[model samples]
Target chain A: MEFYPKLKASIEEIFATMIFLDLTAAEPLAAGTEDLGCHVSAMIGLSGDFNALLGIHCPAKVGLAIGSAMLGMELEEIDDDTKDALGEISNMLAGGIKESFAGENVNLLLALPTTISGKSYKINTPSGSQRVIFPCEIEAGRFYIDFKYSPR
Target chain B: MGKTVLIVDDSNTMRKIVSRALRQAGIDFSEILEASDGQEALDVLAKNKVDIVLSDINMPNMTGLEFLKAKAENAAIKDIPVVMISTETGADIIDQAKALGAKGAVKKPFTPDLINETLGPLL
Candidate 1:
């Protein structure tokens, strides 16, 4: 859980400073998959000292809010604008995690982020990777971060 | 005529943000060109007279570093100032960018002032 705390902090910092939103990690319901009915997702593949997958999942409403905040405009749907916002945030998360590993002597390579928006889809963790999901509450709606990692 | 800028990033959102920051920095760009990756940037560079390039390090197809190397090797676009903008805060990455002939490196989630301060000298 060492990375979890840092992950939480990173998420909060990014949301607060970059998007001007505040995030509070939801308890119990955090990481729950029940309400992923309509959502937006962005993921980046990490390689090098360790292989991992890091991603962000947000509901449509939350995605809109994030997109609007990022672009200084109002977004009504999960369109290209919304996907781009999530992708940038995902990239930031990758960088934040990389910064945390500065003294670890491990070099991490982050692939370009992949984004999708829809309903009734599920994400699976790769074999031998530990998946940790954190559900978070934002002013507009809820979102989550999924970090899956395993030594290569 | 104002300066022309080339913004390169795989994420459309990032390109927009950087463009907005540049505008906010009080840089009056005559034309702002965009590219999804380094290869696309090269395509744009071949025909356009861009004053500077702001690129991201990690991208699909051709990366920013690869593009920078290409720019350095070619005399035509070698002198165009390149400023790297990315989530990569690592020293090695920034150092490598500088070594590859980047004029400056701007960390992601950057502020308009930071962008201006870092890229101002190069311009």
Candidate 2:
């Protein structure tokens, strides 16, 4: 929970400076539920001080919007461009988190980012992991950043 | 003389952002090449005369540090200045990159101005 504010600030800075979009966070979403609709999802694993997973989940439209804005290339649908944008956003988030917590007791490394896109799917976290969801709204649409972590 | 720059990153999106930043920084380039990893970057270098290499530290197949070391050891590509742009923020890693013959290192979530300042003199 303490990290969510830092996470929100990081997302805002990245979107405003890198992607040319401004994001507004909504009330934190209910966490620990597998019933989520993710049209586009990009995930990167965290290792070191603690083991965890971080992901960006958004609808197809939001993904396309972000891709188009960041690349200055027109994109109308969910394609490689959109998927790549989603993955990079998640990558940036994971990297930001790692950098912010670098001085902590544990060392962390981020895994390569992977993207998945579909109508709807469930992301199951380890039962013991602590899960938090930060729901945010952008000019184009709404998206969510999911953080799941557990001490290794 | 116009230059040629190669961007090496596994994520296509990060590559786009880097390329865009370079363009926005007013760096004139005759060509901008891209590769998914270090080995692919070597292949690109084999075929093209790249003036600068912008790379990510963590990638599949071959990492940026590995690529920089390879470039340093190669007779043909040894002089090409490499600037590392990565999420890695450790001073030790940056120092290691410098030791491996990197011209400079920029941490991730970089702004356009940061990119400009880092690469301007080298370019």
Candidate 3:
């Protein structure tokens, strides 16, 4: 079954209800595309019927905007608060995807979320793994939600 | 006097969001306490009088299910009602929580209205 729609819906629901942000999703990026020039990212691991890594990548300004809206405060810079916010968002998104899979009897367990933020960094997956990167746009800029998983 | 509620989640952002949602739900609570994980929640419960608890399932030190088991054994605080707020609302997990003494569960990405609906009856 296709999981891309589920991922897209999860992003839309989270932004609209909790983050209070407007976003439009673009087509999934081609496999092997470069990182989205994002300064911060949050990821969570999933295991069970299948093993997968789900992540949300955002530029500094975009990350701060999301954090600010979520907390109902203005954030000047990317700090612990911003990282924590994005991490929680990643957890929620993973949960959303997990719930969708559950409907089809594909059970999954979620790990705690972790964050990575710095001037320069890159994420690489093992060869032969499958991935889908969804580019989403908010007023501040663009962000990506990538789901990479091993075939069962 | 208004009720005092405890929110247990590792994410500082989530704790803040839950606090705001409680207010938006129009549930007047005199105080809203917070703890980063279930272990901390136990400490807070030991010191203060919390009317109810909102907890997350996955946490670094002492997950929510483990907290429920510990809370159940402590006669002093066993009776206090707990409602889970997490992305993991699958039936199996929620059933485990309920068996361990959790009163209810609410999924993540929830709204003020949903919070009220789940927590209103218990208050």
Off by over 4 Å in 2: A31-36, A121-129
Ranking, lDDT, top scorer first? 3, 2, 1
DockQ of 3: 0.91
Q: Is candidate 1 or candidate 3 better by TM-score?
A: 3
Best candidate, TM-score: 3
Docking class of 1: medium
Residue pairs of candidate 3 with colliding backbone atoms: none
i-RMS of candidate 2: 1.2
Q: Which 10-residue window in model 2 chain B sums to the lowest lDDT?
A: B85-94
The C-alpha lDDT values of all candidates are 0.84, 0.84, 0.93
TM-score of chain A of 3: 0.92
lDDT of 1 by residue, B33-65 (tens): 999999999999999999999999988899999
User: Per-residue lDDT tens digits of candidate 2, residues A47-91?
Assistant: 988888888888878888888998789999888888888888888
Per-residue error (Å), model 2, residue A120: 2.4
Ten contiguous residues minimizing lDDT sum, candidate 1 chain A:
A27-36
Winner by lDDT between candidate 3 and candidate 2: 3
* Cα-based TM-score, every candidate: 0.88, 0.92, 0.96
Residues A18-125, candidate 1, lDDT per residue (tens digit)?
A: 677777975423333454544789999888888898988888888899899888889998899899899889889888888778657667878878899777556554
For model 1 the local lDDT of residue A40 reads 84
TM-score (0 to 1) of chain B for each candidate? 0.97, 0.96, 0.99
